[model samples]
Target: MNEEKNKGGMMSVIAALGANVLVAISKFIGFAISGSAAMLNESIHSIVDCGNEILLLVGNKQAAAKVSDKHPFGQARAKYFYSLVVAMMLFFAGGALGVMEATEKLFHPEHNVENTWLVMGILVFGLIVETVSLRVAIKEIKALNKDGLSLYRFLRESRHSEILIIFAEDSCAVLGLLIALGGTLLSHFTNNPF
Candidate 1:
């Protein structure tokens, strides 16, 4: 049962990782072609998500390490440590950079969104990818949620950190993609990149 639970959690994470990689590449290409700041922001966000997923995997491996004389208590706490690190990265790296970029753009705004259609298309594609990733996470979590706990309570009490993080990341990614699409469309229509 433990193995099955772990495997289910891992499936969500792996699915999210795959989706993030695909969106990151597409966002980068879209940014290159369209010069859209929103696309650039999303590309950077996706890259961070990919890195966070990798760290979660590393943390899982560390948690599974056999006990030794050097530390008989085991390394299970490493998962929490990595989870905290991922949260910090989301704030400091991704969120901060986005804020700084937006401030800069506000001061010296670009004239218009170039290749608007292409940029919007890429964002829509990213939305689909993130939504799929989120659905995978939700499905896995629901299977494990045998106690019929509310999502909020489950997130608070669940010991499954990896899948929870995947769920959160994908949830945020979906929202971000929608916002980017809206901003891109507004910019294109208004002929302003602010």
Candidate 2:
């Protein structure tokens, strides 16, 4: 049963990783075409999410390695360490980049969004993809949660680190897409990048 749960978690992570990679590429293309700082920030966020998923997969695999005499308790702690790295990347890549770009755009007041419709379409598509990924992660979490806890409680107390990471990433991706869409629209209408 535990192995099955782990497999489900791994599948969720892989699904999210695939979605993030595609979304990142699309967002980068949108940034190139529109020159929207929000689009660029979102592209960076998706790239960081891809990296986080890869790290989680690696940590999960390492944590599952066979125990040896040199290490009696196994390497389960590796997942925690990698989770820490993911948090740091989120701070630097997602949070810091968004802040820096927003600041620059605010000060510069340059709006170069040529194809607003294309940028909006790409952001909407990204939202759909991220929603699907989030659903997959939530389904996996439901399968693992035998305690019948509330979703929030389960998220807060669950021991499944991979699922938690996937859920958080997908949620943030969706929110970031929405923010990007709003910023794109605002910039298109106001003629300012802020």
Candidate 3:
């Protein structure tokens, strides 16, 4: 049963990583084609996603470590700690930094030199990738429920928090990407790349 649980969790992590990679590639294409600041922002966001996924995997592995004399209740809660770190990184490195630079850009302003098609393409790809991750996560959550577990109760007491962190980060990323795309289009229409 433990092995089966680990297998499913690992699969979900891999699926999330795959989606992030695909979206990252799309963002790179967006950057190469148009060089829009928003595209650059989106690219950075994807990069963070890639890195965060790795962190989540690490956290998951660590949390799964067998209990020993040195510690009890296993190392599962360590996953939450690491995932909290990831959330901090996202909040500070991804969102805060991006917002700061974007504000500066707003003040100074520049021409929209990015291709809308590229931005749109990347946005679409990101949406799809996030959707896949979300789907897999939901499936896992459902399985947990089928086993006579309440989703909320599980989250409150689960040893592995990678799933929750993955969901939160991916959802945040999707929203951020959408906002970036909207800003890009608004700039394109208003002819202000700021």
Candidate 4:
């Protein structure tokens, strides 16, 4: 793989990885202090995002391997394999855990969040970090898209999975943070953490 050609993808992945790591640590701390299930879910989500970014980086490295006699076309599909694995991780690790937690919360109806301020603070920080990462991914994607297509079209037709995955993960993180913020505020006001 040509570094010059893939610089944007690499930068996007690095930015997302950094963002997820920070967000995950902060969220875990917040969850520990507040006991917010939402915070826990966000922490898991960030960890999954971090893991996905690392897997994608590995995919990049694998794809960069020299063509061998056994495989003449090179390992370009390594990215796709890693992308599939990332998808499974997101679905099983992130989505399934969130769903299970939410269901348990529904049944238990406990005041999980003891410290609203800290949880809210963590959520806001996560939002900011994820948004910045998302912006980086978008900028890199836009640079790669030379056809002047609409954002939706570009996203749909994009071939670069690194930037695409970063964009998606960051977008989900921002949305999750927003939802968590709203839920936290509601719980604080209503005295209901369920």
Please name the candidate that would achieve the greatest TM-score relative to the true structure: 1
Reference-based TM-score of each model: 0.90, 0.87, 0.78, 0.88
Models ranked on TM-score: 1, 4, 2, 3
Per-residue lDDT tens digits of candidate 3, residues 83-186?
79987887888778877887888787765455676667777778878888878876776665545667777666665566777666666767866886787678
lDDT of 2 by residue, 1-106 (tens): 6576346478789989989998999989988987877678768877878888999999888877777898798887777788778877877767777788778767
lDDT of each: 0.82, 0.82, 0.73, 0.81
* Candidate numbers sorted by lDDT from highest down: 1, 2, 4, 3
Better of 1 and 2 by lDDT: 1
Report how far residue 148 has shifted in candidate 4, in Å.
Answer: 0.6
Q: TM-score for model 3?
A: 0.78
Off by over 4 Å in 2: 31-41, 189-194
Give candidate 2's whole-model lDDT. Answer: 0.82
* Pairs in clash, predicted candidate 4: none
Off by over 4 Å in 3: 4-9, 67-74, 147-158, 189-194
Each model's total of backbone clashes: 0, 0, 0, 0
Model 4, 75-190: lDDT tens per residue? 87797799789878877877778788788878987655577788778878888988998998888877788889987888788767777777777888789779878988999998
| Candidate 1: residue 47 lDDT (0-100) | 88
